[model samples]
Target: MKLARLAGPTPVRDKILAIFPGALGDFICFLPTLDKLTRDGEIDLFTRTEYGDLLPASVRMRSLECYEISRLFVSGVEEEEKLKRFFAPYSRVYSWMGSGQPDFVRNLTLLSNGKLKVFPFRPSVSRIHITDYFLSCLGAGSSDEITPHIPIRADALAWSGRLWQQSDLERKSVLVFSPGSGAREKNWPPDFYATVAEWWEKKSAGKNLAVLGPVEEERDKISGRGDRVLALRGLELGRVAAVISRCDLYLGNDSGVTHLAAAIGAKTVALFGPTDSVQWAPRGKRVTVITRNVECSPCLSPVMKSCLHHKCLTALSPDYVIGRLEELLG
Candidate 1:
């Protein structure tokens, strides 16, 4: 993705804090709200430190994994003075974390002098997209369409360019595949992805690259096919986005990387299985979602966990996915 140019940083006036302890996809959904809040005041985002590269330069990042922040979850007025000192700088706080915990909410509200607003991490119902649900919580109209975008840093792009050169694919059209998702049930079969890759390579004469995150690495499901595709492993989030930005098309399950691919404006085809695609599908101008309309699909997480047969995903053949990709490309 190209880096988005912004007018100089917003002037620091009132300090505003946003606490998000969600995964990458959830955080992407919250970006529009973060952008909106920045217009009101300087924003401090408390999230995983690794996501720092994805934030706008004006927004400050604090590590949510630190012990000091974890203190908020403990029940007590014991750390009152310390917590007060920490939150005193913020004029207002919007937290998607700890909404269900009365103690956390009470403490944060008391410490921030009632300036802390808490919202559920996810909507109670799946009637609306997560992005719209987040915006609605911030008093924005649900009808407003907010697409999350990540500006690629120059260094990451340069690194990706070098990778392409080294792989002897600098002039080739490339299709990137990510076959693993956070949930095992969400993933389509690895062999199915290989089949699609073969079809893509044959039809478009394109190079194939597979992004293997820690989850995929642990499972050892999609590696060992070096002859068919190049693998990207052990890269930071920023570099991963950079690699994805240069792809002609990206294919993945309902995973964070899939959301990243869409956010960075990569043409993406998302494969959905046990999840609700309407609520969780990646949002972008050039994104397509492929799913089988199994009667038992879109089941609750508990039901998905217990399901022995992932008919929802298994029923979606590689040929069907390839057909969708062809339509999307056209």
Candidate 2:
């Protein structure tokens, strides 16, 4: 359905709804694109309702709810009928997944009674970062067309900064280390992280260093050295984004936090394990990945039978990563 087009930002009703499914970091990357849309129409969101309240007030201008549009089909075919009746009012329907599921997009098109128009941006890994890739879903055009912006809450930044100041860092090149990843096999040894931290200590003398993660996940990465490195556990994800944005550099395993760091414009050094660099590495000019260039690795199929060793990460010594860090910091 061609639907109606808003050619030059002409007159239209105010309310418009955007369908997005992801965390705050994912949504932050879509800010530039969303901001453009909001200039012409009021942007509502369909996401985990918790995000409705969690988003900063600056972003709160957009209404949000746990509208389970993505779950329309899986629930049952009959549920699709309800979606059609429910969404018939909106003039624009956008799927943040962008060509995610043909059926899903078709459903939105159907629900809008052929009155809603669709726009999506899909890009390859080398051509654009995931953030840009996401912006593309909003029909974003060029790199400059989608500017990088993070709506950080002042209160959250102040709270996180106070927590950061409590550390022993007397003004050092702060590095937010995340020795964690989505897959269990992707984590480098905590000892290796400590080794890199210690090595960087001499290089970044007078700089602060701390690791961010859930306390339950990585409490031991900073066990003995209370003064050198601080482990910030139990931070809200939005606050974590705030902390990462303020940091000079981010070093970590392949994880959402790595994405968060790069999205925030921090210089990042990401370590690859099972995930492919071409597909999953942070999309930034300043970002670099340190891996041993192992063979038969990056097998990211979610299931593992038995492997000889996790040499992909173990083969990369702290010295090698630190050397690259020196070059990057230079």
- Tens digit of per-residue lDDT, candidate 2, span 1-330: 889966797666566777666654455556566677677576666665545424434332333333445444342343465666667666776665535556656665666666554444434444355556665655666563344444566777787677667764436567778776555677777777787767766675734355555543455655455666766665666677777777778888877777667666778788986656754566666678777767867674643324557878778887777788788777
**Superposition TM-score, candidate 2 onto the true structure:** 0.73
Q: Please, what are the lDDT tens digits per residue for candidate 1 over residues 32-69? A: 88888989898988998889879999999999987657
Best by TM-score: 1
RMSD value for candidate 2: 7.0
Which segments of model 2 are wrong by more than 4 Å? 1-10, 23-36, 49-71, 74-86, 96-110, 115-147, 168-170, 206-211, 214-217, 303-307
TM-score of each: 0.93, 0.73
Error of 2 at 286 (Å): 3.9
Sequence-dependent TM-score of model 1: 0.93
For each candidate, how many residue pairs have backbone atoms clashing (under 3 Å)?
0, 6
